[model samples]
Target: MRGFSLLDSSGLPVAKTCFDPANIPEALHLDVWRQASRCGAQVDSLQRDWRFRGRTSNWYTDGVVFSHTLCDATHYQRTPRHIRRGDSDCLVLKLQLAGHQQGIFGDFDHFSSPPGTLVLQDWAIPYNITTTPYEVMAVSIPRYLLRGSHLMYRRNPVITWQPDSPQARLLVPILTQTLKSLATASAGEADAYAAGITGLLDGLLLGDRELLQSKYRERDRLEDMRQYLSRHLSDPDLGADHLCRQFHCSRATVYRLFQREGGIATFILRQRLQRCMQEISRMGVVQKGFLEALAHTWGFSSRANLARHFKAYYGITPQQAVEAARSHQNEGQREMNAPYWRDAYRVSRWLESIAPGASPTEPAGAHGGARQGPRELAGH
Candidate 1:
């Protein structure tokens, strides 16, 4: 597939990329589709015996990713591996146009999304979903874009608006029409449509009072617990029982509050590992017994214990993490000097001619063709 870019009215580039399995050999269809969709989650055919056929068109503009997909029944999962890699940080809003889907999303129990339902998912959380042969249009907005919005602060990461609900009734048609129009829209028209859709979404999410006062109170309590945990992370006894006593809640209440994070124990362990990584990065050198001291400071029993958990959580040993951090710092320094060398090289020939001194050779261009700046879609 070739990528192409279009300049919108403001001269900003809008990129689009597409994938279709029709022209490819049937045997490679699923593999190709999996590769195309790997950016968001792991996908697999759900049928016992099936031949897959699917198409996806994605447009990227202003840090938002808009996509339309039509595919066979498939299973999609965002596992802890995907979360640790930190690639799927967007909040996805999917409009289910046809077929049905059932999934476990964040703290929500198993739920079904019927036709015309708008499903919102925070990609930071893990999910497991399986869909019947379906057609859907989705928009992925960066989390930073909604950082301070009320929607992000909600306790639940997954939400849905049923087809008959007022919110869905108001949004469904506009979203469907906009996506259809984008398929054949000019650059300027697409930009205008995208902007309007974004504005509508912002208004809907921020102005909706679907969350009751009781929900807000629960969210506040949950946040308070989280702050307390952060403050006392080094306390070796920090667990459900400790949290329960400190927050004056029952064990069940504490556990339920952190259920989405895989229970309080998992949450606390992850926090300690993360804090250990931060501390390691700040220390310029790993001194003798540093790992052992750091392990004790972060509530780990010993260096070996810390290494085992760190490797399991982050896919790297603590020492390797320190080495990687130092390597990254060196790479950053090199990057800081790169522009100066590039500028000097650009004028090397003139300097040599004027002063008869040795001059740096210019680097060859990496490619010889029209530069590919943005992604491409099927039509435009």
Candidate 2:
């Protein structure tokens, strides 16, 4: 919606950069930079969608942020020199949408960067290049975000990720397609576009980390609340309906999200008895008083009810469960005694949020079906 001005390739928009190519001039117009200079003498004229280019002769670092764009069937050359020092310690993370590029990072090595190829090389460093007629897109990003790429990779560059990695394939498309549709800003719009560039860069390096972070946060929040409930199950008010009221969610929504294994009441009862067994076993001796006390505390009205459910869930009577727990040092049988039965509820709730009423082609994994609790839990 907002326009951000960025310099782009003169002819068909090809080349290199650190700034926003999306905010540059339209590929057909070519007004971002008035002229192309091989080393300030303007050796190579901006070929009208054809010819070759070079690296930057004199690179400025600390003060100015450097960036450029190159399009298909074009090349801009710069004079080569041994890069000594400058504020720009970063390298170019170039994406090859079409054609093959030959880059000389330190020694001459042919870099066949093909379409969807992502390569990294230093700018404040030094390099030379001989080109063929092909379309290429690149960005001169800040060095800090590239991990060890700043100091370790100038002379000997490496392919951190292949086009085949799930992350690379997912992100490269977004970058290349947007650059190919480059456009200049409407004046005074640079600030907005700069912000967008930050977002785009984050998407590239982070690989949906931000998105996954939120999902973990959601799981943590729910886990914190669930753990707290283990202590107060005896309070009949511990069911999902009550939790919904406390958490300010509707009854149906709470049931759908938090009780997939069984309804809220069932999960609460199970966790309560399991906790009771744990407390009973910790005394190091199986006793009826200890068992009954914990069972009632967790809201089991009578010892009989607790024993019935405990036996059904864990295949053990209260007396036997306590003995087993004590032997394990108060550790309850989590494999079958915990609230696992409730997971289907949470997963179903997760799916509903992303694609309500739609059948998921991919089911959750062995634990709960999805790798992360629920499929929709990704963007949490």
Candidate 3:
């Protein structure tokens, strides 16, 4: 409790050390890769001030207390490959001890926090954060701990509440003490403690039944907005006013929900661009018709307007994206055919070994003698 120490999942104590980038060895990249892998994301250090100190008190629960000065870095959660490989569905609660950070989640709303702010992040969605040099006490809560929270439906993945509030004022100290005391708790004991911990969190988050109901309503409205946008991506008339009329919500309420993603218009434009990119990547621009017509279908005024916004958003023109998609598809095809090509070569070698006169390119029924060659090769 006096100095930085770590307890493994098995309750073994570990010494702590500082990882300073200035003095890092060549293997530092691999170490960073492994750390990111364990944290269930891909990490890129954008700033040179990379200094991290961490201690995993419970590996079984992925609980840790870490402090770092990892400036200008982003962690990606829902990339296709990352999802295919699978991710540990967990929630991270970060108690900022010093400095501040900004996080983007839930349809691109950006939230910023200073010291004494508790931030919640879900591991299943795509979000990014840029932090100033800061110290934080981070606790990892297993997905099961967040059961009944209906986290998936909650559009605001990064929720920040300041510890200065009366409830947080009492809850923060209790949580800190509980975590420190349970640092050595056994696996079974940890599970028991986690229930109590989750109870505290439920109290902190819900506060009262009315507040819980409000959150549910907000979540439903967010989902409704997303659904409406998807269904009417081609409707140029769709905008903040249309959303307010459709959902029967006030303009203010709609704006607040989408503030992090710019405004309602920006959100719609972003979605349209995203949809266009997906279609272009799959069918290519050729199948999607003229860029101007494609733009009209997705609500853009003209091809030039679409091209201007698309380049601004993605840093590339629609034509470039099509080329990239083609390249990616080609690479995928090559990978898929590599094994088949190797097997064919092996089969040809076997046929030649069995019957010298046999042609590798010939079909199995090309010759009576060659037909027997496969049987002889199978025997060998």
TM-score of each: 0.54, 0.33, 0.51
Clashes by residue pair, model 3: 109-260, 110-260
Residue by residue across 24-97, what tens digits does model 1's lDDT show? 44544445455555656666554433234466666655445677878776667676676665554556789987
| Regions of model 2 farther than 4 Å from truth | 1-82, 85-89, 108-110, 144-148, 155-162, 177-380
The positional error of residue 71 in candidate 2, measured at the CA in angstroms, is 6.7
lDDT of candidate 3 at residue 201, scale 0 to 100 = 67
Off by over 4 Å in 3: 1-23, 26-34, 48-72, 75-86, 106-110, 146-148, 151-156, 175-199, 202-211, 215-219, 226-380
How many angstroms is residue 58 displaced in model 2 relative to the true structure, after the best TM-score fit? 19
lDDT score of model 2? 0.40
Give the higher-TM-score candidate: 2 or 3: 3
**Candidate 3's residue-wise lDDT over 1-380, tens digit each?**
01112232345332122334444333243234234343354343323333343321222222322222233222222344443333444456677767666644544444667888877775555554444555666655534434333433244456767776665676577567656655455544544444556667655654534334656666577778867876887988888888888888899998998875677787788778766765564463275556777899999888888899977765567776566444332211222233333332333232222222212223222333311112222211
Residue 52 of model 2 has an lDDT of 24
| Model 1 quality (TM-score) | 0.54
